[model samples]
Target: MNMFLINFSMLWSFSFFFIFIYIITIFSIIIYIIPSLKNTINYTKFKKNSNFDYLTGFDLYFLLLTPLILFLILNFSWSSYTISAWFGNIIFSSFQYKIFFFIFFFYSLILTAYCSSFYFHSKEIYDYTITIFNFFFWILFLFSSNTLFTVTFFIEILSTLIFLMLATSTFSTTYFYNNLNLNLHNYFNPTTPFFFIQMLMYFFWISLISSLNLFFFLILFYLKFLTFDWFIFEFIFYFLTSTFTLKDIFFSLFIWFNLLFSIFLKCGLVPFYFWKPIFFKGIPLHALFFYICFFYFFIFLFFIYFLLIYMNEIFFFFLIINLSLLIIGIFILLFIICEAFYLKAFLAISSIINTLFVFLALNSTNFTDFIFF
Candidate 1:
């Protein structure tokens, strides 16, 4: 109880401090904008250019989130972690925070680039709605927690919505299509950038559904196991103990299989992979920069984080499945490279397949998850 209170007080104080700093920064920007953006603000762009002031102001607010994020990271101590905080089981360590930090770092770079480039291209992006969306995406993604519920409730929803708004802003809703039967075209043309990013996010929603379905399968079995008292074997202890029998071993294997496949789907691995080629079209130079540097980097960090958790559940099933995935990933990678007309398509395909290799290496090693930190 005392620890909880201390943590809560710290959290509250930190958040308050962040908010205070952020407010001051906003006022500072207001002063700067009043003088510098005088022309861009009251005239020329929107008939109602005042609309952008608030939006741009909010857009600038994301800058302050960086210091708070870094402070949380700097204060992170792997050995001192508690499973529950004010946010309810949202705090912990192991590969989780390291992976979170890597993800935060990776996404931060892309976001910085995106915001900078977008500001330069702001005159081109005239939609007030898009400005609002751009703000939410940066803020929501920056603050989204690593916990499962937070990821589902915040990141998955906001990320999808963010891209959807971007997608629609760039083209008529009529231009978007499911078009699964359609082979990807325009591999060498840089004309349509959002079209490609939008399609990647479109398939992200589908992959989300598939991952959830498989995740619930594991949950269902988990609930069933609780009736027979399996939590003592699996949850409380980090590893299987001598209290188990052959039957328990097989059940553990089953649970492990569920975990492996669920993560596989989530990371865009084979058997559930479809979005890559569709979005591997020739995008604008800037869009391609963000896509290649940011998108794949985000997914790869996620894959590493997830793989560390379940890689200990070594069974013949895991071995066989991973080997199969590795073979398939390699074949698809080569075929895509040979067939692709553009470098972007090849890069995307190669990055997707490389995630499987990451999984394979982690699974085959006894290096331990903590070593990755």
Candidate 2:
């Protein structure tokens, strides 16, 4: 119990530090924007034709600084743990250095890709701001998730940010096309506004349903066990399962089914996958890259962690789901190969197959087998 408290306190402090940095970044941007705003007003009054750059060097500097700050924090945390470790005891038992390393690697990759893409492409200040905030929320999600509640909360926040990113990208592109009198039909189908709204509605409904399912499971679990911490929940669940009656077993299975279903929806697996291609089609390339590479990868890692905790008890059920996914994935793969023409749709469908393969790998008994797939 004391150790749990210590871990919780450390986690809380780290989360607070990240939030403080985010606040400071936002305030600094606002300060920069004020001067830019005055310049825009002056240009308007003089009828000058100069373009005022909203995304200045200052904005890019702060954007680049975020990942560096995150790297330093993780390094400091890991080194503190390493320096304090002894024969059979550790100061920060809950800190997973491996996960931190993985996060840092992927985050740096994402930052590099984002910077490169924006450097060559036209930029919008709103898109840049949204992307920065998205990264901040993602860092918070990765580091601060300790309970089921926090996981769900962060998922919802990230979903909202993704939606905003997609909407803004679509809006800006449509406006640019309009200003240039370009034929939108050559690039996109069914007009921008209609397709954008349709995509947003589909994404919104899917996210809402997934969140509700997970929240229902969380509420039920909390009512039964009176706690939200992942380790505590696992311990209590194991203890209760040993003595569970047949009815209790079924009830538990139902609860887990909801939880698993929610995960599947979030991961864009099989039946819940229709929205993904549409969602991908409407967003800008960079936004789509982040959604597929960072967002879905995080969701997959989260799903793997949850399954690892409950694998023994849920083995039979998971096996059944795995086989179903395999059969369905193959058929979907064939159909997509035949029907998918657009690049974004092709990428989206391919990601689903890749995710299905990874989930199939989870059924393997050996670690190397899992890695191989």
Best by lDDT: 2
lDDT of 2 by residue, 1-373 (tens): 2556457545656665566567656754764465466565663342244354434434455555675577557556653443222211112334545565676678667765565444212345455444644555454344446567767776777777777776666645434343232223344444564445666888888888988898998998787668766666456456546965877766766776787689778668755676776766555666677777777777677667666764544443445565666677677567666436666667888887777677656665643443466
Candidate 1, superposed: residue stretches over 4 Å from native: 1-83, 92-108, 120-155, 158-162, 165-205, 225-255, 282-288, 309-317, 363-373
lDDT of 1 by residue, 191-262 (tens): 454446666665567557755765575465556455322223335224445546767666665665665576
Write down the lDDT of every candidate, Cα atoms only.
Answer: 0.48, 0.61
Per-model TM values vs. the true structure:
0.57, 0.73
Q: For candidate 1, which ten residues in a row score worst on lDDT?
A: 172-181
Which candidate tops TM-score? 2
Candidate 1 residue 172 Cα shift, in angstroms, is 12
